[model samples]
Structures are given as structure tokens and as C-alpha cells.
Target: MERKRHHEEASSESDDENYVPYVPLKERRKNEILKVTKKLGRAGRLLQEEEKKESTDDGGMQDEEEEIQVGPNANMSLLDQHSELIKKAEAKKESAREKLLKEEERILESVAENKALMGVAELAKGIQYQDPIKTGWTPPRAILAMPKERHQRMRKKMEILVEGEDIPPLCITFKEMKFPHIILKALKKRGIEKPTPIQMQGIPVVLMGRDMIGIAFTGSGKTLVFALPIIMFCLEQEKRLPFVKNEGPYGLIVCPSRELAKQTTEIINFFSRHLVEDGYPALKCLMCIGGMAIKEQLDMIKQGVHIIVATPGRLMDMLEKKMVNLDICRYLCLDEADRMIDMGFEEDVRTIFSYFKGQRQTLLFSATMPKKIQNFARSALVKPVTVNVGRAGAASLNVTQEVEFVKNEARMVYLLECLQKTPPPVLIFAEKKQDVDAIHEYLLLKGVEAAATHGSKDQEERSWAVDQFRKGAKDVLVATDVASKGLDFPDIQHVINYDMPEDIENYVHRIGRTGRSANRGVATTFISKACDESTLLDLKYLLIEAKQKVPPFLAQLEAESEKYLEIGGEVGCSYCGGLGHRITDCPRLEAVQNKAAQNIGRKDYLASNAADW
Candidate 1:
């Protein structure tokens, strides 16, 4: 038992020597923090050494090493350093952004200053920027201060007279006319940048709400002169009162022929298209003439139309049928008024005029003003301004006139010769439709591509033929007065009068087809014994006024007619071919007068015989 006790004591002493004591929680936490601090110090020294090595190696090192050295205990300190680096970077980026913004502002201010300086410089140079279409804007006085030579030329070339309350100054360029931007753009697209002499004066007068009598030659841009102002006025009206159902047309354009009406409608619609595209209300222009489906026209009117271009006959038909109305028409234009009257449309025109009740603006445009036209104007117009571009009934100076004294039978041969000598696109004028057909057939047989247009041909065929001629599909066009006055053929090289018209004014219009818009052209007239003596004298003076060379035959005819006036020789009576009186004053009258005188004598003789019985 003593040996076992001694062994137990030795074992207990050994166990006590190996046993460890329990520590407090706070003391354990303190020791752990101290150990982490020491480890962080070591990690910092190692990181410095690695950074030095990386700098020497040009930063070619493993990124994993840096992450491994960062212990969980040191995470807070590393994060704080990262936040400080981010703050420094943000400050530098903000400074750069501010500098850039300041530079951009400076640039914008400099550009604005430069623009202001440029405007001031332009003003100092006596250049003013004027908006032509601005209300109350008058024409610049500088336009009247033209060069002396230019003024002299204008006076000699154009006979412009303005008689009204206040006439607007003449426009040199189309820009000076103060058209809308879209209209100006359209004009530019059409290459019509300059205004003709008549347009320069006539457009403004018409816009002033005054009646105007524009006496200008054909192809003188008269269409635009009246058309522009009418369009502008209609647009103004549209702005005031939007289009309504069955309001009737705002403008009425009367043409002598269906062809002219079609052309005028096309022009109006062309300008109206731009207005529509620019977000304005749709402005529709309809062509109301014969030879088309009236039902379609009526439907168009029902749908809504702003303008109507019509002939007197078709318009009368529509008016009689009550298909259309013109009661609310604000503008009335009579194009080719003389021709309208001469074609026996006077009564129809008067009938149509009676429908308009309220005050309306009227414009009369004619190439010539005769007694009848003057009378019509006096009755219709209200103190209209008479604007004449040149002398009335004067031929164009651009045409070279040639009068050939050919017999009636040789006229065709002479025309063929002229055609062969001249270029393509010759317009031949005849007195009758049969003559035109005959000439057209002959030209076809002669291997010349030709077409004919007259009243007998339907409107479609006539329009097709005109288009063919215009497109150069046909070279020659033979027609009567139907193609004379208002048809615009730009490439007509020659105008040949196969038969002289009875009216000298028709002759002027016939040749007026050529030499239009200041282009050079030729006019050949075939004069025969059938031509009257008075016509010959008129031709002589017309040729002289146009600065054309008068043939010796016309000169001799004029001299022979003047001899009767110079000497006291008896003038031949136009009625009986007797001497000493005019047609109205002729004493040797008709057979009825002689028979009445004989009856009176017989009554006296019977009375004497009764007394003797």
C-alpha cells in the first residue's frame, strides 16, 4: 500500500506541472488585438518592400499578393485609404468639368459678340435688312434713284403710266414684290427671279384693292401680275374665314376660251399646292369649262373649291343649272376682255355680272382697247387705274415681219417654202377650220409631222395635239384664231399667216404668237388682192411702229390710198362702189329706194290722168 501511494503522488505532481489556468474574456480580446497590430506592422513593411520591387519592375507583379497581405483585422484601415483616394480623384474630375464648362460658355459669348459686331458693321455700311412682305413696308426710295441711262432706256422702251390714288413703286426683282416665302421659292424653282415691266407695275396696283386696266402685250407675265395678288388676297380671306361648305368661290377668273381657263387653273393650283404643304387650309382651284364632265366639276365644287376659272358659256350653263354660285366672290378678273366681247360674249358677261350684289374688286386686262371695250370698262369698272405698258394695238418689236404678195392659190406653196427654210415648230394661222385641215394634211403628205387644232376638234384631241406640239412630237401646228390669243407655246420659231384675217387686230394676235418674252422670231404674212385697201394702210403703219422693214407693195398701196386724200378726188363709196360718199351717206342707194321713188311719180301721173278723163 505504501509503494502505490508514492506512485500516485509522483503522477499528481507531473499532471499539476502540465495543467494551464483559465483566463478572463477581456484579457483574451486584448491579447488578440495586440497580436493583429503586430501582424499589420509586419504586413506594412512587406507591402512597402513589394511596392519598391514593383516600381523597379515597372509595376509587373501579381495583384494576388497585395490582396493576401490584407488581413480581415486590417480591412477597415485599407477601406479608409481607398475612400480617401476616391475623394481625391472626384475632386480632380470636378475641376476639369468646371474648366470645360467655363471654356464653352466663353466660346458661346464670343460667337454672339461677333454676330453683333457683324450686324453693326452691316448697318454702318448703309445696308438695311428689310422684310419685303412686312405690312406697311413701302418700296425703297433707292429704286426711284436709278441711273440716268437706265431711266432713259425705260422711258424709250416701255410706256408705263400710273393714274390712281396711290400707286405702289415698280418692283425690279420678284423679291421686291413681297411675295410669301413659299411663293418666292416656287418662283425660284421655276427660274422666274425677275419681274417683267408690266408685272412690276401691275402687281402692286392690283394688290392695293383698286380696279386696274392692264394693257400689255401677250406673254408679258400678265398672268402672274393679277394672279399673285388674287392668290394673296384669297389667302388673307382664308385666314379670316376658314373654308365652309357651299361658301362659293373667293375668286372668279373669266377667260374667253376653254384653253385659257385650263392654263389659268393650272397656275393657280400650282401656287396653292405650296400653301397646302405649309400647313395652310387646302385651297382648291377648279377649271369649269366646256368639253368636260360637268358632274365631276359639280362634285368638286360640292367638295369645296376656292377659285373657279371659267369661260362665259360654260359658266353661264352652270349658273343657269344652279350647280355653282359666285355670290360671295371677292375678286373678279376679266382676262382678254376685248376678245371676250369680240366673240359675242358681251351679253353673257353682262348676265353673269348681274349676279354679284356686294362690292367686289374688278380687274380688266386686254391687249387692245377699242370703243366697245372702253364702253364696257366705263360701265363695269369703278375708276380703274389705266396701266399701259406700251401703245395699244402695237406689234412686238422682237418679230421680223415679212409681207409676201402671193395670190390665194400660191399661199400653200409659199407656206411650204417658209417651213422648209425655217426651223421646226412653225405655227400656221388660217381663216377657217377647213383651211387648217387642208394645210395639216398637206404637211403630213410632205413628210412633215404636223397637227391641227380648231373648234371642231374635241377638247381632249385639241389638248393632246397642243401637248404633242409642245413636247416636240409634232413640228407644225395649223389652226385658225382658236390658237392665236392666249395659248403659250414657248418654242414657236415662226408664225405664218396662210390667209390674212379680215380684222387687222387678229393679224397682230396671230403674229404675236411668235417673238414672245423678248425672244427673236419671224412672222410671214401672205397678202393677196382679197385684202382690203384699209387693211393695207393699217399694216404699213403697224410694220413701221414695230420697226420692221415694210415691203414695197405695202408702201405703194399706202401711197395710192393717200393720194385720194391729198387731191380732192372723189372717194369711193364702200356700199355701192360709187364716188363722193361713205357707206352711210351714199345717195344712190338700194333697189328698194329707187322703186319707192318710182311709185311716188306714178301716183302724181295717175292724178293728172283722172282730171283729163
Candidate 2:
């Protein structure tokens, strides 16, 4: 049995060696093609079966077959039966194809019907699809959406003028202005029942969607005059386009200084916070200024903001980087317009205006209207309602002005004496940055808590000084003209001009800082021979116009004295030629006196020096 098994295994091994294991590539490819063809045929049969089932279920078609009994004399062959089955499968496939084509046509018809319904709905809602490429798209009824009769009423009440046309009177109270209940509540919470003169007139004009140039005194509530209207407009826009996240803000407010920008943003926050509490969408306000980090600002912008309060220089930087775009901006406000022009930001302002090409409501609030500012207004603003609350280029009547005549060498001594008598929280202004620093140092040395702010100081240092002064940590703040405009510090008792400003308009602004928000304050200016004669007459006029006491010396200066007196010419001590020190205080004079005293008994040295001289 073992030999037989061995013989079978040996025969199997010999057979394996004789047989070829690998097939030719051509024959293998042909076999694969045949296998694929059979699979495709089976797939087609399955699809046809599914379609037939669906058709029967729908009661559209039915298939019937009768079974035939095969007797001993049956002549049907297996090959003939297979061919008959194939023909039946082909017929089912054809029926399935026709059904698919019909279903496709039905689907197309349904889609067309849906599109038509949507178009009709849009038309009914009065929603017009504007081409973004052709026209800058702004939401319909985004702002100033009041009815014509109500608008006319509001205009008449506030004496609102549009293109020099007078409308009918409207409501006077905050509630009558049709502000949201929450906004009115916020105003009430702040104990602000009556609007200031500027707000009373400016609000209605802004609400009517008219461009405006508001000339109001400092602390006349001008900030709120523009801020409240802007907040309302932004809220309206937010409601209209809930998902819009523009690259830039919808409302852009440009101020001359960072502090003013920050102040405006705070006001926006104060109003917007109430809106969010009343179930409205939260309005985001960004203060983009030089001292803050640009990256953080960029991040906030990316998250989306409704309003942007920015200074010209920092805003220009962001604009150049393409981080912000004002193409869709609807409202533009230039706060402290005259100050911005005076700071040489005219070109920057123009560049910013060029970026906003669409229809925008512009509001310019300035303390004074200079010729340059007037020209800027003509070019930048539309037919705006000019609201002048008081006389232009005049100081506030709330502040009492006094001029003290002191020698240049005694100015610091006078400042120290003034500080001893006056209350804390004093703002001191100097003409030059060096003088500001020197005064700040001198005050510190004299045991008076003081801080300094100037153009030469870094942004961080300037902000620190302002913050310290605001918090009462520093009683005195010595600053240059940079702080003379649009900075609001509550309860500031006095403003001291340690050195008189060369420009008379600057003197007006310097004193204007103290008497803010109807608070009574005092402005004391120190006059010396070093001051330019040209500004004396203008200064006297300003003081007199504001009902301030003008000194006899200043009132007597001639108007033509400015042309004769060189601005920067020497006008100090004969010996030292230094404005801050007298001939008696000169170091060289002291040294010569000490030498002469030491050589009093040396006759030989005196005779030799005299002969040489």
C-alpha cells in the first residue's frame, strides 16, 4: 500500500513539472475582458429587475408568464430556453431606460417651478438684487427710514435744513426723536433729560440723512450730538444686514488725537451696551490709535466691528496695509476738523475721503471754522446743514481768563506760586516740548506730583502721563499743544499757560480745555518779553470777546507789531542771551565776579591783564 501511494505522489509531481503555471499576457488580458463583460451583463439584468419591480408597485405595468408542462414528446432544448431568457432581459432594460428619462424630465420641471416661486417672493418683499461690481451695494432702508410725514415733523421741530429747504417741525424730546426705548432709557439712566443746543439741532439733521457741519463750543455735548445719531444708524444697518462682516467699519469717525478717539469710542460703547441688553445685536466699536498694538486691532477688525474711531495717522497706516476698506462705509465723521487741518493732516484726510466712493452721510464737528477748514468742507461734504451754536473762533464764556506779566527768569517761580494757591488737577501748557519737560522736572523736584506729555515723548509715556493725571495720581500735567484740542478731563479746575503760544488761535484752545461741560474754570496765562508781539492784539481781542479781563499791556499792542517783531529773534538778558535766565543769574557773570574778587589784592596780575586787554 505504501509503494502504491509513493507511486501516485511521484506521478503527481511529474505532472506538475510538465504543466505550465504562467499564462501568456495577451491571453490573460482577454480572459479579464471576458470576466468584466459578464459582470456588466449581470449588473444590467439586476438594474432592469429593480426598475420592473418599481413599475409594478406603481401599478403602471405588469408582467405575466404561463408555465408549460413538458411531456415525453417535449421538443424544447436548453440552448433555446437560454436565448429566450436573454431576449426577455433586453426588453426589460429598454422599459427601464424610458422610465428614467421621464423621471429626469419631471425633476427638471419641479426645479423650474421652485425658482419661479423664489423670484416672485423676492419681488413681493421689495428686495432688489444690486450688482456689487457696478454699484456699491447698500441695504435699502438701512438708515433714516422714518416715514415722510414723521421726517417732515422732526425737521420742522429741530429746524433741520436740507439743501437750504425747511421742513415741518418734529418732536423735541428723546422719546419724540423715535429712538429705541432702550436708548432713551440709557439716556435717562445717565440723567441726561435735556439735549444740549448742538444735540437738539444736530440730531434731527443727522436723522434726516443730511450731511452736516456742526460748529459748537467745546463741552457743548458735541460728542453726543454726533455719537447718538451714528449709533442709531449703525443699529439700523445691523438689522438690515445681519451677516455682513465688512473689511472696514460701517461708520467711520476720524479724530485728530488718540485721546479723542478713545473718548468717542467710550461714548459709543456706553450707548451700544444698552442696545445689546435689549435683545438687539451687539454693536462693536474699535478705537484704532497709535499707542495700541496693530495686530490686536487687526484681530478685532477681523472679528467684525460696526464703528471705528481712529486718528488720521494710524488709520492711514491701516488703510495702506489693505487691512481696512471703506468702500461700503455709509457714515463718515470728522471730529475736531479744524485741529486736524492745523496738525497738517489735510492730505491724509483727503486720501481717506477718496477711499469712500459711495454715497455717505458726512458730519464735521469743529470748534472753529478756519478758511482751510471751510475749503475742506466744500470739497469733502455735500450740501450740509451748517449748525453754528455760538460765535466762531471765540473762547467759552464759562472760563475766566487772567494774564500775569512776569519776567522769563521768574516764570517757573510764578508757576510754583500759582500751584500753591490753586486746586489740584491742573493742566499746564507750554509752547515747546523742551519747556514742557523742564517744567515737569522742576515741578517734580519741588515735591509737586506732576506728569509730562509732548510730541517728543513715546506713545506709552504720553498715555501714562494722561492716565496718571486723570486718576489724580499726578496733580499737575505739563503738555505741549498736542493736548490743547479735544481732550476732555472732568472737573479740571484750571489751565495754566506757563508760556504763551505764538498762535493766538492756540491760546483760545488752550484756555478752552478747562471750562468744559458747563463747568466753571479758570485759565491763567504768563506773559513775558520773549512772547511775539504779533499775537498780543489777537489775544487781547479773544479775551475781550469771551468777556475775559484783558491786561492793559496786551490791549495796547498794535496790530502791525507782528510784522515788525521777528518771531524767533533774541529778546532776553543782555548778558547770557538766555530767555529763562537773567544777566544776574548768568553763570559766566558769576565766574568773572569770583575771579575778580580773588585777584583783588594781586596788583601785578591786574596790570598785566589790563595791558593785554
Q: Candidate 1's residue-wise lDDT over 223-248, tens digit each? A: 88778887887788778887777677
Instruction: For candidate 2, give the lDDT.
Output: 0.71
Deviation from native of the Cα of residue 603 in model 2, angstroms: 63
lDDT of each: 0.73, 0.71
The ten-residue window of minimal lDDT in model 1 covers 111-120
RMSD of 2: 35.0
TM-scores of the candidates in the order shown? 0.67, 0.64
Q: How well is each residue in 330-449 modelled by candidate 2, as lDDT tens digits?
A: 888899887786567867876786676465777888777643345446544555567766655557889889898999999987898887656999999998888998898899889999
